[model samples]
Target: MIASVGLVRYAKCVLFGASTPRPEPDSGKVDFSAAAAAEVSVPADFRCPISLELMKDPVVVASGQTYDRESISHWIASGHATCPKTGQALAHQNLVPNKALKNLISLWCREENIPFDVTESEPNAVTANKAATEAARMTASFLVETLAASKETDAANRIVHELRQLATSGSDVRSFIGGAGGIPLLVPLLSSSEPNLQLNAVTALLNLSVLEANKKRIMHADGAIDGIVCVLSSGATWRARENAAAAVVSLSGVHSYRRRLGRDRRIVAELVNLVNVGPISTRKYSLDALASLAGDRENIRRLVESGVIKVALEAVEDADSADEAVAVLAALAKRGGAPELGVQEGVVRKLVRVLKNGSDSGRANAASALVYLCRKAGGGNLVAELAVVPGVEWVIWEMMASGTERGRRKAAALGRICRRWAVAAEADRLAARYSDVSLTVASSTRMAVAQ
Candidate 1:
């Protein structure tokens, strides 16, 4: 084992020659021929006992077991190679180049007349080298095509099974089909002439969109957004619309994609309108996408100017739909950073009122949003107003008082806010009362804090 480790170290040192930095991401073709052409004479000990060869196929000499050369080479390359007999790895330096290849090499040497001298000769063998290189290249090309076909076939199977699952299962079966390529394969199917396949494709893409990476690719794919919107405008089934809206919601999660949907008339005019007009379920996800994208500053101004904010605000007012108010408030807080916009006129006050009267989750979201808004607004006045609002102080006080498990969690968050506020307010009062002394104290305190 120690000898093997030493051999590996020596081999790496010789091969890598001082550990140079890796090249940047490949832009041009990778010259595997160049790499294969670089090999020198095979190491002596790495020769296979069975063939007494240079280990042409890299057969594994494992615990009374032998692997084909290709299998052994692949395992070694992946750092998975082990001796079949002892389960110990071969020394990294002990590369078993094809020695029986000597006959081939000698013929090539005579034909090509490249010397055996390392300083003067080309490294590749003469006879079998060209055949080996061609075989490897052809095999790699074939493997790539095979994998692509397999992915398309698997996607078709997923589409069929997914439809049956969608109809019979209680929840969306997206989590079951996981892969970076799933979205790409299913996108083309969304526009398939076959209705069942088209429906299943939409369902699959919707599920794929739940993942951030998949959604990025789906949106970037040619005509994907337009195809989905066309489906929406064509009066597809509610299930289809719901899934489409979910995909839009996923796309909207990326801020840069806001404008991608703008030019698609089916999206802006048809789907955006559905936030207020579609069936209850469809409207929910559609509004969610609209609300999230509305938080993008330019998109927010565009949406508001287009009169969509009013519709969203109205939804917040409906008694049966008050649950959505939290989402509306959160979105507005994100888009409308300052209380001056509309936070002062109504949003904050309404959220504050809800803090006293709404359900626990709603009240929690409202309270969190108010605190966030106040912090962003950055004023002593806003802080004072929040501190003294009817039930606001008591709510915080009760939160700090409860001492239950959840209450303890809330207490930690509130404590940090209160601590910062206390320090900032005290610094202001001291600066006014004892200007010079306050400067000295603040400096000393700052130094101490830094320490």
Candidate 2:
């Protein structure tokens, strides 16, 4: 049976141009050319061993020394190379060469004096030497076609289609718009009553506006900024607000819009008002935009003075718990402007109150803000006194026993506060004995439940 099987294999190889003489069973010599030719003959072997394609998105085979489109392609097709021998999936870190393919390539390269270049961007050494100019030309042509397709009147139902086309077109969309004549194509869609149409148009514009040319178009279109602001200002659907926020975020990135957001002041006031009165979704988006702008120190100071901080504080006071307020507070704390605005001006006190009594999220953000404020407030006795308010300690202990990640993060933050507030020994002991505390807390809570 073994002899018959070997004869059948030899017959198939012969049909496929395998020209080497079959070795006797005792022959130790390996036949390189015949094996290489046989491996190459099966186009399936030529398919990407990873993706199983004809070397599309090719990766180096695990043996780490060869370059055969066929072998790599085969590995992809067979799915044997997905997980390593130990069963760990082929993550980005475990990449190695396909030994057979590498040996073949090295043999071919040695014979032909060709160097293999296999960087990710140059995965196919055979194709790597192709002219960049030629590739760019093809890419530009693709973008032009896709840009045309995306402009179809019914872009609403075709968003996925448009997105795929846009992505494939590469970066030319921005470069082309930066040159000239693209704004006219993108502006009208902003006013479309159809939410999806407006969303796609705004998104496309946001993408294209990254370049100088499209930004000029935005300013040239007298109503583009107003239209975006209107969408943001209105109680449009969440998707619309998200799109509007994205576009606004993009426009705000342009120097042309900087004055509009800052010196001109109208846009800032409107955005702040949205933070106070817009729907919860709209408010979130508005605050996100504000947070982005506040990266500029002047903008941060302006927000502190805008009365929005008080409004946010009041909202936290009014919430059933503090989750809704935490995101905003975390952003403010991250900006580190509390001292300049005066923590003693009531924000700090209220935040400490929230840290002691607010919901898990609120306490976390408030705790974070307190840490920043204490450092900024010069880490004096006043801060320590505030840190250990009876109420705050009670809340911290309660949160340390909670199950949520936010609860845990809050508890950790509180522990840091305890250490900083001259309770370092206690905090250290607690850290060293966390397991005991956890068990005690669990048992006591359960017994309390039984009682």
Candidate 3:
């Protein structure tokens, strides 16, 4: 069986022109010809062992074998700690990005017209299939070359712009970029002490992660999430904050990573601060990240203690973010033990306000938050408070009469619980349920978020 398997493997390799040259044990000289193919031909050394494709990004393991960055990242995230090629136990999980090899492969790619771009302008407006097809055309080779440098600030800025464009371009582009070793190469930039470089790298990763495969690779890459959280917990420009938060949102969405992510108080605090005062983009991502983090019940208290509830209440006033904010608030409430925190934070009134005048989606989510807050053990009494809000009954009735199917169900359910159950009242109900509570905690959190 073993001999037959070897024969089949050899046949496959012969057919594909894909095989790694093995070095003899105890021999100091490893054959260099196969891996050292000239720019005119693809180098076998550039191909990842797992994917059997030329590696755009290569990383070495403890066993001294190299594989594509995405392949290895996914393997690590799935709980393996062994070299794919040698099956040797990994000494550690840290991945050292292979910049030199990437540089060589990138140079070769440029020469082959495989295309890479670091653009100042957004080329993102194109569709994924279109961009993928067009990838054979000249890529912004200048940007590609710029990325290979360690200290080219101007080039790095353009790298961010072009990466963002490609991220938005579509799946094919992201798949191509990921397969080309883009994620592995770019992830190191997130850890740079230079704030600009970190910002550019994170923003690019945030965009690149829209591609499904890139998400796994970005999450497990050494220092990627930690660096992003550092920027979030510390201070950066609003754009940087927005980009960082956006990246966190993407990473936190993966369930396996959320447990570790939720334990970070800095992450929750900064996201709460961003929810309170960051720009719309930042707020949106923070809200989503919070929602995902809340999935871990252990993180709920820290989130509430960090002022997440109050900031989320205030966020309802933003037309663009109200839906997401309310959804996050609902998730927090449902997480157990944190239901009362929302009531104390004035979530009831903010939700009522959303139900009264927020867009359809916002109304539904707000209604959901209100229902959870009023029905939970710690918050059941708050149902009466919400019942008396001037327009509460009217909003519920309005939803049942004209809102979306899901929204109407939430409104109807809330009406029944509060005994303000009538779908008939038209009085104004959206009002502040309580003044901001424990501003001391929130104040301290804001300091961490910005200072």
Candidate 4:
């Protein structure tokens, strides 16, 4: 029995290693398998159509399609004009956050034992360092308090300028400023007579308006639109007016705000006036605001009545402003302004030049505007005119052969109209020639009879 026991002990020692416990897996480290992750069934709605992956930040485009913010932004930046999934042309490129969807996605991730940091997914949230973000928040709070207590004009300007810088730093800092009640304080200074104070205050509001929440806050604040319009209409300096226009653009991102702004005819008139006479930069900013507001029918009417067509026609002739000008024209055409555009002299010719040699976006807009104009003017006259323009038909043919999907559609429509007009004209000439030949033959027969 003792020999058997010794033999058993020796066999266990050789096979299993002597007196060593099997090391438990390190509790701190968990190994996750890629295959296992692949096997996880993510909901379809949780995935971005462009990336085909779970969305970290969901944003809804004007087409009402929800996509990952980065993915949709890249799509728009790459010159795509339509929604990826629905293929509808985007009315505007505003990417409103889908907070409810984001919350659902976060909840799903937690339930599935996946790691997702919601705060890290903010569109402009500064997440590189928690300590730095906290410091910025604290600093913003202090500045807001100081600005509230400040009675000296020089000191107020300096403080407002600092707050503007902070607001421009990141979305988090803007949120902090808004949270600290900085918007109300800034609104009162928008109409300040002091140039620097007015500039700084309007600029600070402009910077803070970048965040969606701050946009609402700024819009709803008492006399905010009035103040911004005041600055835009009669600010002491061009830079202040430019930023005031920019702020209007930012606020008009929301549809309701656009309606409210449309109610104020002065806003539209001021922007039109700027586009007519302001410097290059100010005109550009004014054009941007006008473009955003042009989405509403009332705003389009306001723009037309304010003489936008004349300035837009002039802008189309200038290379610096042609693209934005064409885009605005297209928007107006889509929204009941086509008749006015059709009445403008040389508008068709200018658009033809753009179609031949403008940037991709400009070409697309020009094509769209021309099509709308032709349709509104009764295709025959405009189509005949277009068919005769030097190289216009060739440009249309090329666009049909090779262009973006939307561009191709517009080009094909224009080409069809032109071709139909050409064919009809050729048929009429042939028929007239045949009639003249028959009449001459009859005259010869009559002469022979007389002889």
Question: Which candidate gets the maximum TM-score versus the true structure?
Answer: 4
RMSD versus native structure for model 4: 18.2
CA deviation > 4 Å runs, candidate 4: 1-88, 91-125, 427-451
lDDT of 1 by residue, 363-429 (tens): 5445555655666666455665555566666666665564333233443454466557778888988
lDDT of 4 by residue, 213-322 (tens): 78889988998988988998898888788778877876776667877887788898899889988877577667767767776777778888888888888888888788
TM-score of each: 0.44, 0.44, 0.59, 0.71
Q: Higher-lDDT candidate among 1 and 2?
A: 2
Worst 10 residues of 3 by lDDT: 24-33
Instruction: Give the per-residue lDDT digits (tens) of candidate 2, residues 1-451.
Output: 4334334433443343222222122111111212233223223233331111122223343322122344334334535443211111233323344455544544554455544444333333212333432343333344344445554545332432233223222234345433434445556666777555555566556555544445567767867766776666552355455445545544554433644565435556776776676555445445545654554445656666676566566656655424445445555555766665344456656777776666544565676666666666565644666665667666666767772444466567756666666666567678879978899999999999999
Candidate-wise lDDT, in order:
0.48, 0.49, 0.61, 0.74
Off by over 4 Å in 3: 1-146, 149-151, 156-161, 191-196, 296-298, 317-321, 342-346, 378-380, 420-451
Model 4 / residue 287 / CA error / Å? 1.6
For model 2, the run of ten residues with the poorest summed lDDT: 23-32
lDDT of 4 at 337: 92
N/CA/C clash count, model 2:
22
Estimate the overall C-alpha local distance difference test score of candidate 4: 0.74
Best candidate, lDDT-wise?
Answer: 4
Residue pairs in collision within model 4: none
TM-score attained by model 1? 0.44
Clashing pairs in 1: 54-99, 57-69, 58-69, 62-83, 62-84, 62-85, 63-84, 63-85
lDDT accuracy of residue 47 in candidate 3? 53
lDDT of 2 at 393: 64
